[model samples]
Target: MDDMTVRGRWIRVVATSLCGVLLLVGTLFGADDDFPFGPFRMYATGPDPNGDAKDSRVEGTDITGRTVPITEGNSGIRRAEIEGQEAAYVATPSRLSEVAAAYAEHSPGAAPLQSVRLVVRWVGIRHARPTGTYRDEVIARWTRP
Candidate 1:
């Protein structure tokens, strides 16, 4: 090969090698920023039944027969109400740190507590009289580690 041809090929190889090196370096150390990972997921499973429960009897033939009672108690009626007002949001690491800082500023003693998972549960509202006002209660579970 001519001298110029050999020099040109050598330069091309060096340029490619330098580009690869720069790419690797950028991937490793370019951005030291935190990104949002997850807000997680939650699901509710169980009964949300309907019908009267009073005179309804759960006979073995009830599932196959047509002579069903319209009673109040045995109707197997149920419902679920979920409140997501206080759900957590996923944020970047820096944002999380800011949140921690805010928590620390407001409640110094509670800052040490580690929040892991949040559990949502159903609250049942029952009425005393037929026209009585309903009551609300929250059923919750928490995970600590």
Candidate 2:
């Protein structure tokens, strides 16, 4: 084969290899995916049992056995006691407050408000599930009290 033809084929091969490497790297570490890459920010993950309370509290242990506090801003803390055959989950007021703060910081366009309602809808199960399997899902809504 001619020297020019040989050189052209080598360039094509190199270009193809570079493209493949780039595509692989993009697929592995691209930031355009819909999933969030940061920490899990879920507060609660179950059913809402409280009818409504202006101030409420939920107490429980985190995945690390540390006390988890769930508190309300406007005297809206309601009690939700989840009972199982062998155990019960109680959410505390301070834990609820932490959830609210995290939500407020993470939510887009959340403004300083007079009051906030934090609702814990789920409690994490410890031994019954895997680590980080239990998620306490919470919802925070700002209102004029």
Which candidate has the highest lDDT of all? Answer: 2
Model 2 TM-score is 0.21
lDDT of 1 by residue, 45-137 (tens): 333343111211111112223222212232222111112222221222222233223333554443232322112222332342232333322
For model 2, the superposed segments whose C-alpha errors exceed 4 Å read 1-4, 33-145
Model 2 RMSD in angstroms:
15.8
Model 1, position 73: C-alpha lDDT score: 32
Give the TM-score of each candidate: 0.20, 0.21
Across 35-87, the per-residue lDDT of candidate 2 in tens digits comes to 24322223224323432212233433333444434333322333442112102
- Clashes per model (N, Cα, C within 3 A): 11, 31
Model 2: lowest-lDDT 10 consecutive positions: 81-90
lDDT, each prediction: 0.32, 0.40
Model 2, residue 9: displacement in angstroms?
Answer: 0.5
Worst 10 residues of 1 by lDDT: 52-61
The Cα error of candidate 2 at residue 3, in Å, is: 10
Name the Cα RMSD for model 1. Answer: 22.7
* Deviating ranges (above 4 Å) for candidate 1: 1-4, 32-145
